[model samples]
Target chain A: MANTEQVKLLGFWASPFARRVEWALKLKGVDYEYIEEDIFNKSSLLMELNPVHKKVPVLVHGRKVIAESFVILEFIDETWKQCPLMPQDPYERAKTRFWAKFAEEKILDGAWIAMCSLGEEKEKAIKLAVEAIEKIEGELKGKHFFGGENIGYLDIAMGWMSYWLPVWEEVGSMKIVNPLQFPATTSWMNKFLDHPVIKENLPPRDKMIIYFQNRSTELASRPHDWFRT
Target chain B: MANTEQVKLLGFWASPFARRVEWALKLKGVDYEYIEEDIFNKSSLLMELNPVHKKVPVLVHGRKVIAESFVILEFIDETWKQCPLMPQDPYERAKTRFWAKFAEEKILDGAWIAMCSLGEEKEKAIKLAVEAIEKIEGELKGKHFFGGENIGYLDIAMGWMSYWLPVWEEVGSMKIVNPLQFPATTSWMNKFLDHPVIKENLPPRDKMIIYFQNRSTELASRPHDWFRT
Candidate 1:
């Protein structure tokens, strides 16, 4: 069943948040116009669409606009229920959402700080980031995906591990996601990347490294400015 | 219409996160046993129930346990369909979640810091907190509640403003939510307090002042320890 509704996504190429939404849209086989956003020098359309956060990924479905990636993902799932993102069971759904929140609030922030800082600050960040990774590993519990058999909300929310974590690890010169340590998460990362939709959507690893390396250099000089970006 | 499942809430009396969940239970008229935990000296049950965060406001429904107040609110809304906390429309639900998240990530932390710190740091915290309040005021837009007609998820998430903001203001010696500056928020605050469930749930103002005063004193001495508690 082809969707006739006009769907557009304003996103930056490197944003893990944007990538999560892209994966969801693709998995559901929904066609959308993807607009590349310059996050550093944001577009007027981006500003007009998401005046509150003024950030991507912003989803515009016809006249209605939605900001925040998790919100956008839920909106997409609800609007196009062809491939359900959230579980039907309320308890299971709540568990999925809890981990999704954890990915955003706890995991991403720590990874960002770890990748950006240097010296003792960097060491502290690494410890915190690893602790978060261990928590994710605990959640995995030998499951193929966070959603058991298929990729779901928690899987999409944690999509960053496959692409971004590697770069962050390389840039920070740290190893938080090794198969030796977190076997379940490491395996999940591989499986997540191997998924056709996710595989196709992710940017090249070599390119990501270069981009992150340059970004990391800038962040190292201004470590305290982690929250601004 | 009675719930036969065993429902219990592990919470701290002073925590706003815990309060939000408590209010949701009260509003839903769900019979639940409220267990006040000593957060400073973690209860074994609290640690076991919420091994990841080991934090307050853990909701136990039958055999299932849910942590994080926002997650619990969603769970409660889903489990008990009557007197729904979230909007039925997906867009509206997303908007509610967005603001709820903003309240947690931006508003509460700023308020905590502002009320805790002294001198220059306090001024900066106050600025950030006021900015967040101004944003909420914009969202209010002449509404009685964040949910427009009813006290919904966003309202519950921001319930802290009604109880905690005044205490914080008194401790910080700053006025962020006055009728002159944030008329809409000020009005909403009053309306929130007037709600029977909310009115009944909140702690005594005098006791709150004493608790917050002691907290502020401790935070002032160890400004960097803000995130720990």
Candidate 2:
């Protein structure tokens, strides 16, 4: 059986959102042409493809274009039924979706604020980030992964935090996820990053550090643009 | 052929998020016990059910508890396969999810800011709200509903806007979705609200206006509390 659907992805190298889609596609054993976009000077094609957000991690399957990383991940899972990223049972799927949304809203967003902001806001964000991490620690109590024994939907969704959070902490000279405080989350992070599919696909850590260092310096001068990054 | 599983929904009357769940349940012909929660004086059950956010629109099915309207909607659709809220095709489902996310992040959030804020912020939010609505108007160019003919996932997700936006406008004494500017959106709003399930489930208009009026007054007094509501 020869499948001939032209699958393409527009992504930024440092964007966790883009990386999630890339990982999902890779995990499903689906071949895709990846286009790295310059976040500073976004391409016209990127804008045309995702007019609403004009953000990266846009998936184009033949003529159908899908933007937003979560949406794209689900699309990949459904389009290629080989390795299921989502669970089969409805209840399990819902729980997975709930935690994934939490990762984005609480953990990721809080980490961004902690990294990008200054003084009171930074301290507040750090506290919130630690709280979110602790909650996830409880979720990973006995399970090896968020999706028990396998790196399923939630593991992929939250995998970027393992690499990026460390980079963010270094760039900010702050500690949010203390190993002693969040041992379970720390263990899960180690397990998730150790996975071949995830380990191979992540942006280079050294490069990410340099990138964030530059971004942090840039954001310091322009506080208003902290969130845009 | 009977559903014996215990189903319950904890919701708030004025919340668009809660209304979305109610509409979804009615569309699927699912019978469930509805418990209204007081947002001011928090209930123990609401807090226990949704320990993280402690927000309304928590769906308890047997032993499983699901929070967040979008997550609950997906659960409802998957659990009861009768009137399918999501499209059968992967591509179409992806698009619907994208728009539903857009509705929450852009339209709903923008509308909140427009109604809650004062002076410059309100004006800026109003501009953004119009832009989001105009985008949706373009999406509804030739379609009767966001789902086309039938009110599907997106229509249910964004349906609250048809009723609540008008109430916000009346309370604020400002017009965001002018009939002249967004004809297609205006038409779709009418069609959506006219749907029997939607019409029957929505909170009373006059009561909503009074509620928003009081809320706007309170928000005006305490500017910091604007976004939380």
User: Best candidate, lDDT-wise?
Assistant: 2
Off by over 4 Å in 2: A1-3, A221-229, B221-229
- Tens digits of per-residue lDDT, candidate 2, A1-229, equal 2235889999888989888988888888889999999889989999899889899889998898999888988888888888788999888999999999998878887887778778988899889888888888898988898877777889989997789999999888899889999888999999998999989988888999999888877776553354331
What's the TM for model 1?
Answer: 0.95
* Residue pairs in clash, model 2: none
How well does each candidate superpose onto the true structure, as a TM-score? 0.95, 0.96
Pairs of colliding residues, candidate 1: none
Specify the highest-DockQ model's number.
2
Docking quality (DockQ) for each candidate: 0.82, 0.91
Give a tens-digit lDDT track for model 1, residues B43-150.
Answer: 899889999888988999999999988889999999998889899888888888888888776778888887888889888877887888788888898787988788
